[model samples]
Target chain A: MPDWQELVRQRLSGLALDPSEKEEVHVELAAHLEESYEALLKENVPEQAAVSAALFQVTDWQDLQRRICAAKKRGHIMKKRLHQLWIPGFLTMGLSIVFLVTLQKLGFNARIVSWRDSDIFFYAPWLVSLPFLGALGAYISSRAGGSRGTALLASIFPALALTLTFLLMFPIDMIIEPIIGRQADFKIVAAALLKDGIGWMLFPGVALLAGGLLAHVLLSLRPSSRETAIG
Target chain B: MIGSGIKRGTAELAVLSVLHDGPLHGYELARRIEQQTNGALRFTLAALYPMLYRMEQQRWIRGTWETSANGRRRRCYRLTPAGKKKLTPLQREWAELFHALQRLTKVSHA
Candidate 1:
């Protein structure tokens, strides 16, 4: 019988492949031959005959290529779907936290407190925190593969942020100018938020924003890997 | 003569079936296919590696690096669990097609 390796080399010499990939094929094909040889041996074939018989059972390269392509295409589609869902929720919450924390750090004590019918400072940070909730909702919807959903989410987040800010500011007006009974002192509200610890409320909003942006980048870049795979 | 398009797929099924038993390097795999076909089917190395690489991507098979008898390092492949599952349906389909083709030709009354 021909040297098995020589026989293999002669057969495969036609298909040109990258060196590393070629090596991979070589090992796999060898294992295939060994198993077939064993089976032939069991059938009482002579040693030479069994080895040669095992070689006869092999398939061609073109057929294997088609199967691999189909499989890769399927894997690509699955990964794309996953990218669509994961981007939005992660970003919205991240941004929200950052916004809140940053505001707090700036010593902006924008909160409203009434003592038996009296206004206090404007707690702007607390009000701003409310808008981020809507933003989070929009982000989540957007990432879930709905263009309309993402647009709706993107549009509503700003509205929620603004509405919360507006609603909270109402008490600020009450503090500045007494509408009814004794008005709250706006200075006290400002002082309270600026009191070192209260400044940290901005941390959450900033943190949320950072996380949101990170998710967005990851999703956007998801397709880039295809280039390398194709290469 | 088999159509070029169908021939490739048929060859892959045949090759995968052989590998289903175990791993084999490139040259061995090609020779075995030719031997099995009784000289009907010939496998060329030029086409083998690319197909093997593609199969590796599909997760139907996995390749591991090993040294050959000649002390040359090469990567070898074996059927994965996923590949094992795929073989049954593929084999069924192949048999169905083969029988259908034979019936169309009306060669024998076996």
Candidate 2:
């Protein structure tokens, strides 16, 4: 007898079927063999002829992949949009609320730093971290629910955070600077960021590294079929 | 056999007709069509599942998970009421198209 299970697996190897899907294909192929055998016997064809005839009827895996890809491509735009608009926006809003509430609880003097010094501390690290955080957020969301959720969260959160932060900066500067009006000695900040330059890129460079790692993690977490095809 | 669009259409129709009988997994569906055609028609997986899924989206068929006699689970497809209704019209159109093709081919041969 033909090893129908093995035959089916071999046929399905090139196709991007997850374990469950592979098992499904196996059962279907085995059932097909039974039907093929019965028909061949009725026709008085030899067993080998029947098996060969049956094997010839199996569908081509490559064609199925192409079709599935085409279908996904057609429908994925809407999925991408939902991701871009909804999930990340929520994350950003949630983060902003937390930041605002925490800052409000802190006394005014606690935040009353020289405008030049505080602004540099507040904006500079953020300038580096926001994109880094955005990349991290994107990476997480990409794999969030097998890629779609990640893409949605990643796109929206960064945009939302950047917009809100920039808008808040003008008002925040006006409020803080009148009292202290101090500026950071740039040389000190530059030295702090550049100390590890040989080992890492300066401020922006470190952020970029975080973003790249985030992308890797995000890309790694996609569903098996897509990952397998890509690999 | 090699990129013939009309032949591909017939193959799809034949596959749909098999599904009309009941839900069969992909392999069984392919085998049934070949047997019915007496080994004349062959379906590739590329062609079969896409058509099946398309028909599914169109509400012409429905699929469900079923455990087979072999103690393995498979996704099987069956014709819906809508599919049955659509099938008649499609079958009629196919017949007309085939007839037209045959007549044209005959004239060319003559």
Candidate 3:
């Protein structure tokens, strides 16, 4: 008839488990102790002896607390990673598709191999959006406990997807033939692909870097007011 | 009574073997483990719950809260296919270890 729940809560107070998880552990332990106490009582054990026997179960409460907290922390990290990285990464990919379709509607051809001024203008919007997309990714990653490297990697996902798609769809010969026709040799086509690929990627890559660095800097600069106060 | 070290080492297999019978709540699982082991192996809430949570996380066992006839809600743990798959290998390993120990010590089977 001891307040087993309160006892459990007090024992678990130092653990880093969130409120709900702590409550769950509290309830489960209380239930277990209650059962143990009842079983002892059924055998005509004295109340004090039953309580002592029940309490004896957890020989090392400190070790138990550490283990439970560590397990919960790992689970939290996995869930946070999925939410932070993949969700935004996929959303960005969806938005990129919409942006590409809009560009096509505006009479901007995506398949042009030439580095004409018009071609540059056509690709400019996609390139311009990359920094913002990267910023979004980095911001989310930072919020989810990701390091600067993780943020940078997350920011680069959309660009990586685009690059992979282009390479998969059009080989150098196929790409160059459409732009320069038969006048372009394999070497010229290869050179153009390399040059244009880098050209298209350069701004976006910088944007990703800038966004990741900016997120990291901003996060590091901000005071961890809550943790500080708690500590 | 078995040493805590030995008890803890076999805790997972013990729980899995008991749960192979059917789903049981934490209290029932602990009670059955003690009863079946003839009080040699006993699990405290501190020791058992963490292992249960770890096994649940590993997808070996699944826990679900169910209301008893008395309207008390308790989390019951059941063996998953994954847990069942693990039991045979674990049993074999323990058997091998016991045989080796018996051979080395010249001890008869208890």
* Cα displacement (Å) at residue A217, model 2: 7.3
lDDT-sorted candidate list, best first = 3, 2, 1
Give lDDT tens digits, candidate 2, residues A1-231. Answer: 777778766765654544665565455555656666667878998988888776665455555555654543443445554554356545644553454355546632122125433322222433344454446455545443435444434534534344445455555656665656764344343454344332223333344335634565556566653452131
C-alpha lDDT of candidate 3 relative to the true structure: 0.75
Q: Which residue pairs overlap in candidate 3's backbone? A: none
Tens digits of per-residue lDDT for model 3 on B1-110?
Answer: 56778777899899999999999999999889989989898777887888888888777899887888987668889999999999999989988988898797875543
Interface RMSD of each: 7.1, 4.1, 1.4
Q: At residue A50, what lDDT does model 3 achieve?
A: 99
Candidate 2 per-residue C-alpha lDDT over B74-100 given as tens digits, one digit per residue, 9 for 90 to 100: 678888899888778889998898799
| Weakest lDDT window of 10 consecutive positions for candidate 3 chain B | B101-110
Which candidate leads in TM-score? 3
Which ranges of candidate 2 are over 4 A from the true structure?
Answer: A58-140, A145-153, A156-231, B1-4, B10-47, B53-60, B69-74, B79-110
Per-model fnat list: 0.08, 0.26, 0.53
Give candidate 3's error at residue A160 in angstroms. Answer: 7.0
- DockQ values, each candidate: 0.07, 0.20, 0.46
In angstroms, how far off is A65's CA in candidate 3?
1.2
lDDT for A211 in candidate 1 is: 39
